[model samples]
Target: MPEAYLWDRPDGGVPIAVAASGPSSSALAGEYADGVIAVEPDAKVLELFDEAGGGGKPRFGQVAICWGPDEADCRKRVLDQWRWSPLGWKVNAELPGPDSFAAATQFVREEDLVRTVPCGPDVDKHVEAFNKYVDAGFTHVAFVQVGGESQPDFLDWAERELLPRLRT
Candidate 1:
């Protein structure tokens, strides 16, 4: 095999984060990577990572959220767009494509999505969802607003309501 090298290398190296959904991978991330990222607020992942020497390292998490004027519509939108989220990474990874995901998540209920994701215009619910990650030792938390053309509204609401509460 021929050797390959980078033509340009920066003075400051970039941080590497490993996305892990299971025990082994989480431990591996702790052992090798600069940080770990998980889709859910799973304390066990962090525990395992910390045990493997990832203590004090950045832990990033992501959650799905939907905010709108109507609570029912927001719930429906999250259910329609992100119902597949509760399937867990193993099942989500095995799916071949969007059609397969749709087929797999067809039976997912709105309440199921609500249990995991904060849906609607309630600032408290959104804050609670973000807090779950924070309480799980995650240093940084990000959210995915599941909808269309509502980014501006969401940002505004988050800035006015969510950010202040989380800061406190």
Candidate 2:
């Protein structure tokens, strides 16, 4: 095969994966790709992906998780950094600029963010958040912290507190 004409990857080649919003895209991923990077944490998507692919390879998931030592601070941080996330898929996908996203999410409340984003310090809450994807058939996970947290501290706390629970 010819060398990849575009895209960058480590070691000169990338394991291609599919970004799927639902069953249709997941089906395509299942058929031809290594795995699906799901945006929505829905078990049915994984089932469809596996079924379409005629059963397993690897299933991975990415979930936006915002947390801190303090729940209130975590909520505020989530609001400041990810308020636009609640704009829904259509607006989020079609919006061209940060201004559009900001304007679109102007009315969103912090409480509502809890529904879609894991925003708080409760260890169980965070564990449950990740478990939702894992239970849905994801073999791996992407813990994206959107709230501009101290990465080292977050990782430390997670390793000590979060990782243990998730492992079990």
Deviation from native of the Cα of residue 157 in model 1, angstroms:
0.7
Candidate 1: the clashing residue pairs are none
Error of 1 at 123 (Å): 0.8
Kindly list the per-residue Cα lDDT of model 2 for residues 1-168, writing each as its tens digit: 597587656885667888776667878988988878875677887888888882767777888888787778877888888887666554677799988887888889999888888866788887887888878888888888875546777888899999888778
TM value for model 2: 0.83
User: Judged by TM-score, which candidate is best?
Assistant: 1
Q: Which tens-of-lDDT digit does each residue in 9-94 have in candidate 1?
A: 56787889999888898999999999999998999999999998899999999988898878899888888778898889889978
lDDT comparing candidate 1 with the true structure: 0.88
Error of 1 at 84 (Å): 0.4
